[model samples]
Target: MMEFTHTASFNGHCTTLPLSSNNVTLDPTVKDKWGRPALRTTFMNHPDDIATMKFFMERSMELMDAAGAIKKVGSYAENGQTGGVHLLGTCRMGNDPATSVVDRYNRSHDVPNLFMVDGGSMVTSGRGQPTMTIMALAFRAADHLIQAARRGEV
Candidate 1:
């Protein structure tokens, strides 16, 4: 009997550009029970994302073959891969209000007092482990908010 293990790398930079792609719109025809317009998403994977996944899958198969596997069956493509636990980039952070929802400090551009300290503030999806980064960002935002409050800057 031969042992087989399957694993995947969780590293892909497939976010929409700040000014383009993945445009979200309020569906005027579709409404919830509360009579509020539902959000419609237009998301597509970047070409680079597909390429990277293909490369990783090929490498993994090569490794498996080297390990004396008699039969190997693996595919990164031809099968849907919804491989993300941490959804990111809903509200991106940037310096400009025209492109970003939040600023560098995770503060809303429209509302100075409103701070968004979460994964939504991330501009990129990051490499799989986003919890730690989110926590750090939260701490950083908290510290900044506290200092701003102390200085009467809201």
Candidate 2:
């Protein structure tokens, strides 16, 4: 399946570069502000991704042929992989001692007791919309942070 990793720095710098190996090529040939070959994206799908695509095409063809399709044609994934599900980058937030810049209450990691106090600190949002989860994390973190302060964990 197509998968990618993303990282965001403490300074709010984030990037989402593709990591898949699928042949789903895209010629992003253009010049950038710095006079660089902007980018030419060509993803070669992972093995599982190709397999999944093949299965889908095969099944589709069989079904169509069974239904007496006269023009039964098929093609498989050349990149050889399943496919990537849309799992975004930087969807992580927590109070981990390291790696994460935000605490459970969404506070900056390096700063002492200073909080980002924003929605970007959330770590995961499961399946539902992230808005609701971020709000919930904020509420929970606020209460817990207050309690921690009372207990001297900060």
The alpha-carbon deviation from the true structure for residue 51 of candidate 1, after best TM-score superposition, in angstroms, is: 1.0
Q: TM-score, each model? A: 0.81, 0.36
Q: List where candidate 1 sits over 4 angstroms from the true fold.
A: 1-19, 78-80
Model 2 lDDT per residue over 47-125, tens place: 5545655666777777776666655556664544334333332323555756566666776677757755544554323
- Candidate 1, 47-154: lDDT as tens digits: 666676777777778777777666666666424346546677778889999988899889999999899888887756544567898898888889999999999999
| Model 2: residues with Cα > 4 Å off, grouped in runs | 1-91, 95-97, 148-154
lDDT of each: 0.72, 0.52
Q: Best candidate, lDDT-wise?
A: 1
Worst 10 residues of 1 by lDDT: 9-18
Q: Give the TM-score of candidate 2.
A: 0.36
Q: Where is the poorest 10-residue window by lDDT in model 2?
A: 7-16
